[model samples]
Target: MKRDAKNLTNAAALAVFWLAGLTTVVVLGAVIGYVLVNGVGEIGLEFIFTNPHGVNAEGGIWPTIVATLYVTGLAMLIVTPVAVLAAVYLAEYAVQGRLVRTIRFAADTLASVPSIVMGLFGLALFVESMGFGFSVISGALALSFLMLPIVMRTTEEAIRAVPKYIRWGSYGLGASKWQTVSRVVLPAAASRIITGIILSAGRAVGETAVVIFTMGTMINLPVLPTDPGRSMTVHLYQLAMEGINMPAAFGTALLLMAMVLAFNLSARWLLRRNRRMQG
Candidate 1:
């Protein structure tokens, strides 16, 4: 009787897990399919590859695309090194105690802060106080803050997940601590680190409020880091909300989605290649 009861409970738990996973897939599929259907028609050489025209800015999304790339690229570049170093220090060097706990707690709290709140903070610190004005640099600084905690946390986890036997082998080979970390551990964790970066970038690329608050809505190609520019998310929001161009809005959103999906797929491919090579 007890055996039969255990089997029944296990079956029920399995069913619930399967149902939850299926629901997630269905919802994501539906959203992606709907966006592709609505915006696929507007994607073309001219629409994607040209710049805005006239006072109302009706043309292509070239400037916004450029701006989006600038912000995402710059933000990632700014945070990736520091995040890796910080994670390495915490995970590999630091003795676990109150200080490590406090550091982790601070990062977790920063990560939980709302993006809009971060935007406001950026507006005051970078845009106003620092006199950077509304530009790619200001937006990138704000977005970097958002990405740092996530990247650092993931990197630490990845480093910790490395097999202890591997570390032991490195020590047996007479490698110094720094040499072991730089040559073996970091290389091992590289795939996971890249994955974290890609995930943070995916979220940052579509950040509208931060862009609007820090980077001005200038519908032109950003020639310099200090030049004010508009991102694709802000463009989509204005087009949809202001009723300037609904179709363009859909197209812009679709393109943003596609860019993210493509990057994710590419990252997966790279990871697979690395794994196969290692094998």
Candidate 2:
């Protein structure tokens, strides 16, 4: 009787898990399908290549695209090194005491803070205080702060996942602490570190509020880091909110999604290549 009860409970749990998975698939499929169907028709060479014309009612999102790439790239550049280094320190060097705990707690707290709140903070610090004055650099700095905690935590986890045996082996081979960490452990965790970076990039790509607060809605190509610009997300929001260009907004959304997918695929490819070269 107990055996039969156990089997029944397992079956029920399996059914619930399957249902949840199916539901998630259905929902995601529905959203992607709808966006592609509506947006694909609006995409073209001109739509992508040319700048907006006639009060942004018509033309392409070239400037916005450029701005988006600039912000994402600069933000990644700022966050990657800092986060990775911080994670390495936390995982390998820092004594597991109040300081470590406090840092972890701060990261967790920052991660939980809402994006809009972060945007406001960024406005005050980067835009107003730093006198960046509504620019790509300001937006990139804001996004770096938003993504730092995520990248740091993910990197810490990846570093911690490296086997103790590997570290011991390195040490046995006369490698110093820094050498062991840099040459052995980091290479092992390269794929996961890249994955974390990709996740952060995705967040940077989709963020609107932070960009709006730091990078003012300047619909032009930013010639300098300090030049104000509008990201693709900001463009989409402006277009949709003004109710002037629904088609363009949908198209921009599709492009943003495609950019994110491309980033993920590229990161995966890089990881595979790195593994192959390492092997």
Candidate 3:
């Protein structure tokens, strides 16, 4: 009787688990379908490529898209080298000691800080002290702060994912530690590392709070650095907050999602190609 009771309980738990899983799938599918249908319903080629002009809910988002690309590009440029180096040092050369622990703690703290706080820091440092005056550079730097932790964490994981035997084999070949890391281990982990960086790019592109405080809220397609660039995220935030431009805001959101999807898909394709070539 006890054995039979246990079997019944086990079967009940399995049924509940299956039901919960199906519920999750249904909820996610409904949300995604709703957004895609409403958001993609009114977008046209001209709306995407033309610059936003009047503020009376008749503007395009091309300038916003351009600004998003510029700021995200600048952030990636600043983040990639530093994040990769930090990951390399931590994975290949760091002696597991107090210093390593401190660094790890610091990284964790930075990662946990809110995006709005990072924006405030940028407002203080870049906008006030550096005299950047809310330009794309300032916004990019703000985004860099937000992205650095993600890039470093992901890159560290990628580097650590490399097989131990690969490092041993390189050492057996009389390669120096740096050579093994730079030429062998990193190359092996390149696809994953690049994927992490691209993921950070997507985050940077979609960010709103940080850019709003640091990048200023100008709508013109400014000429980068010297002038303010209005990112798509900022535009969406404004539109959504204004409460009367829901359709346009949804459309902008859809475009942003499409951009992120395109980037992720392209990155995956490239990674696959690289893996095939390596194999």
Candidate 4:
């Protein structure tokens, strides 16, 4: 009954896999459900549109929302070019050498480092050394550092996933190195690259520790380059950390989740549009 035993073993493994998958889904659903239930009730039009007021009576999240947008936008602006170029070099230009290996190792190590450590590094470098003094720019720079490894790795993967045939076709057409990459391979791989960027953007939006260290915790809506700002994450952290304000904190957490969910949905829609266009 050797064949019967093998089949039974396989069946047992399948059952375990199914159970594990189900458990994960259930746990995730429960968490999201709880957050939504608690947070949705507190969200309002004013909360969504108004800026954070220093006085508790007047505070809305508008300014925090604006600041969050600014920080995340600036971070993306700074990192996108650098990350894309680095990815291109690693994937297209760099030969298998010591430097390339070193870069790969560095990227992996950076990605694995805990985010709070990155915050501490940013605090030392941007806040202390450069005397950015806890402004939006400093916060944005910190986020850019956090985002670089993720974007670079994803971009490298996307480039690698491009079919060699496409590269060969471009080369056969007498395209130069950059031309082949820009024309055939990059266009073919753009959707995946965008997806990676969107994923990283989500991470940036939710990040608290780096923002907290570099951006500061003042609840006031900050001015542009000269002033400090509180991101939604920072706001949520304040609310959550205050033991007396559980309801407000929960509500803010829910709102943050909603914003993240909205961004994710938008990204998915864009991804689908790109795929359809590509097809």
| Best model per lDDT | 2
Report the C-alpha lDDT of model 2 over 79-99, residue by residue, as the tens digit: 999999999999999999999
To one decimal, what is the Cα RMSD in angstroms of model 2 from the true structure?
A: 2.9
Which prediction has more favorable lDDT, 1 or 4? 1
- Output candidate 4 Cα RMSD: 2.8
How badly does each model clash, as a count of residue pairs?
Answer: 0, 0, 0, 3
What digit string (tens of lDDT, one per residue) describes model 1 on residues 1-279? 999999999999999999999999999999989888988888899999999786556779999999999999999999999999999999999999999999999999999999999999999999999999999999999999999999999999989988999999999999999999999999999998998899889889978888899998978899899999999999998888988888788899999998898878877887788779777
Q: How many angstroms is residue 34 displaced in model 4 relative to the true structure, after the best TM-score fit?
A: 1.3
TM-score of each: 0.90, 0.90, 0.90, 0.88
- Ranked by lDDT from best down, the candidates are 2, 1, 3, 4
lDDT scores of the candidates, listed in order:
0.92, 0.93, 0.87, 0.83
- What's the lDDT of the predicted structure labeled candidate 4? 0.83
Instruction: Give the TM-score (vs. native) of candidate 2.
Output: 0.90
Clashing pairs in 1: none
- Which of the two, 3 or 4, has more TM-score? 3
